[model samples]
Target: MLSNQSEVPSLGPIQREQAWDQLQKNEFDMVVIGGGVVGAGTALDAATRGLKVALVEARDYASGTSSRSSKMFHGGLRYLEQFEFGLVREALHERELSLTRLAPHLVKPLRFLFPITHHLWERPYIAAGIFLYDRMGGAKSVPAQKHYTRAGALRLAPGLKRDSLVGGIQYYDTVVDDARHTMTVARTAAHYGAVVRTSTQVVGFLREADRVSGVRVRDVEDGRTAEVRAQVVVNATGVWTDEIQALSRVRGRFRVRSSKGVHIVVPRDRIVSDAAIILRTEKSVLFVIPWGSHWIIGTTDTDWNLDLGHPAATKADIDYILGHVNTVLVTPLTHEDIEGVYAGLRPLLAGESDETSKLSREHAVARVAPGLVAIAGGKYTTYRVMGQDAVDLAVDDIATRVASSVTERVPLVGADGYFALVNQTVSLGEQYGLHSYRIRHLLDRYGSLIGDVLSFADGTPELLAPITDAPSYLQVEAVYAAAAEGALHLDDILARRTRIAIEYAHRGVNCAEQVAALVAPILGWDAATADREVANYCARVAAEIESQQQPDDEAADALRAAAPESRPELLEPVPVSTPVQT
Candidate 1:
């Protein structure tokens, strides 16, 4: 229950307690597990269609694979090589909807050059694929692809070595802050009256004979447990899909395999490219993307069988990426040039192919049990469609004729007045006594909710000052995260809300104390608790740094998993055995 001033119910500490109480006292039509993009999208779709829905997550929203993606919203270009046209077209349509209508403020069009190595057959082959890509179903907004000779390509990206390519083709895609977009979707669900809570783990399923009727959940913060009754339950967990399906004591229609993708961040000046570059790799493709003040070079796709919560990026992973990307760069990036490293797992639908890269990005939906529906294996771009599909199946269990999904016509919370606010950036800066540049940055992150974020600084203007160590972000951003964005731990603020962890060299260790102090009062943390939070965050950063130096996944997992858990009550998961299928 936030103050009456907010357009939606702000998911602060007050509202969290209310949601927990309501979960026990009332029965919902649907309860969605997992707070990743698809889970949040499902909740939003159900709520908008006039259903009482609840969403619960084991950790913070997007804490898993959703937060750690390559941060793009494009059709998988290489999938065209596999002749997956329907998947590509669906993704492109979703990308178009996001860019023009859904979240114009957060999603921005970006340019990328696909370098041509062999002179003869490469150009036409690549050109035809991109030609189909640009003219796909809903790609009316972005510019068409253009061919560039070797000299022209060098002019656009001078950092590329002359010997690497004979020519290139520059094309358009889109980029986003994945964590923020996912959080915004959750908030929009709350706006439409869905109950959403984080740091709440589903321990078991409640059953009526043969079907799931509800869930038993534990508050990770305090170790308290409650049972939530729902007519239908949706398992939207990405990597944890199988674990949850096991709890239902039912046979899942499909299995999910985790594929690890690693990315490294370096200073923007490390490459002198005006646009991003894409190169073909032996296994797949590598992207050198532009991310604000840094260039994000990534993605090694391999099988990972270690900790699903924290996917560790080993020294071998870093070396693999640098070796591939360095082939095209004028100055090869080394270990010292790296500022940040992150790894995420993709929950691909398991198939006969052993190669994780060869698995399909196409998602599947199944009515695993009478009252439980499971959806898994889709790219980030098509999350909304996956949600609609999941809910469409769950509606059969509800008995009532539910309204069709209205999420496509529904704008997210901050999207309405965003363009108007962009036009008023100068005036907003003058009124708030800040620079126009800073105002633009706030606008991009918070959109029309910028006023709600700055409202915390009404009497205390010093809160508007930049963070001492991470000067790129203001101090008030941290406060807003704790007060309104459902940030229960220091890692939630530093890693997801503001991205200071991945953008800075110290990886949020330097600013941990100051941030903890700022949110202490809002979260009702005493002096001892604040100090403990700071200590844990610093230790976590140290563990990650040490883990990255390891030679392989096994070594990295040992170091990273040994670090302290922000939610200490959440111990090792005990496997729940599935009953024999009827």
Candidate 2:
């Protein structure tokens, strides 16, 4: 939070209306489309540099690939196999910077053990890569990698099969709540005077002769059209990059390919391991991440041409992950063990290779048209670099009189005074009549901004109580999601704001009605409207679960698309425009 924090710049109903009013009438130096990590980072970068900006998102922030990521802030160890040393080094530097300064509260160092089956040559080969990773990150990165024997590795990870490996290596990386981090970034941008609005979709580009000027955006919350004027427009949509480019009707400089990855969450007791594991599969790498009270086992990289918003995971995909991990686990996990499953798409830069895994994770910035700049293809670790690069190109096109990228010096919303807040957790817990552990959870999620969240439950003591079905989160979280955060739909609250969807066994269906009732009054929803929201969210969850049981991608996609959409206006028609061919 800032030194003179005023409720961390609330993004409630009042703020959204004001933002849209201003966006329709005023002209900004730059307007960024897509509220993912890169887009939010870009908005912050531009706002800090004294440029007037507006950030618009069709869905919630981090609703796409950002929220459904593997949640590791790594330098892509496997990239070294491709001999892309420059990319690895750049990502490593950014990873270290984020952990130390930019988002210290959100990103925390995590240890991962890499088991080696063949002792003689395999250790040396992996050791060389670890050495380069540490060297590339300077002294600011995570602790240097360590070599471990079979006995030491077994002590660290008792769940592993005895014959699975002869030795292991432990390395450090950072982990975070991806949705929370992205939302905080957007809030930070709003605090710095950038207009931020969600559920605003860009229908087409506003052009003056051959030069692009702004965008024609549709307000999904209310059926209305508005032209947001800006000197330069930046397209930062990740998986929707090519789709946004085609809207401009300009000759695209590059192409974007979507790759699907799925993760399944199970109980923490399912895998009795102290450290996370990185298993090398024949096709790619599989990560067993240690999430709170649960384990996240994931990620299959395959080409996906299905729905971008609702990427479905097939039965085969789940079977593949379970089968591979079972080879190394003493007690293998089954489909019944899964508490939640999520699928996301990666926007890789398309080129000669048809394989999505072979596509480049490195992003490119190009001036597709006169005043339009597009950025696509980058991993979560390197988003800040991508944001800086995107802004640099946009400013060049606009020729705006602004300072250089100072985002490297700007900390996120909760980064300021976070350590001091941690020290006062016990005092705060006593003041609120709650356990220190509960206060610690609030501090980690909200940092110094915990005051804003706690203040909402001050008069209403019942609001501080833990939810009935999902005890991990407090009831006040649901209220705060609507009263402060711009969560208009129940799905937004369950899936993104609090992460109850993936953390709970019922996948948020068990608590849907309760959450809807808690947030209804704040969002001005009547009994019937609240019931509709709950019903819609329940339908979505049921469809997703059924989709996961399907045999293949086609079957899964068909089943998932049959569910009711929370934001039906998103599927409504807009002022159509000609899309440039590939």
- Reference-based lDDT, each prediction: 0.91, 0.88
Overall local distance difference test of candidate 1? 0.91
What's each prediction's TM-score?
A: 0.98, 0.97
Worst 10 residues of 1 by lDDT: 1-10
**Clashing residue pairs for model 1:** none
* Alpha-carbon deviation at 479 in model 1, angstroms: 0.6
Q: What RMSD does each model have against the real structure?
A: 1.6, 1.8
Per residue, candidate 1 scores C-alpha lDDT tens digits across 1-582 of 222225767789999999999899989999999999999999999999999999999899999989999999988899999999999999999998888898887888999999999989999999999999988843488778889999999999999999999999989999999999999999989988899999999998999988899999999999999999999999999989988888777888999999999999999999999888888999999999999899999899999988999999999999999999998889999999988999999999998579999988999999999999999999999999999999999999997889999888887777778899999999999999999999999988888899999999999999999999999889999999999999989999999998888899999999999999999999999999998899999998999999999999999999999999999777555343556374
Candidate 2 error regions (>4 Å): 1-3, 138-141, 572-582
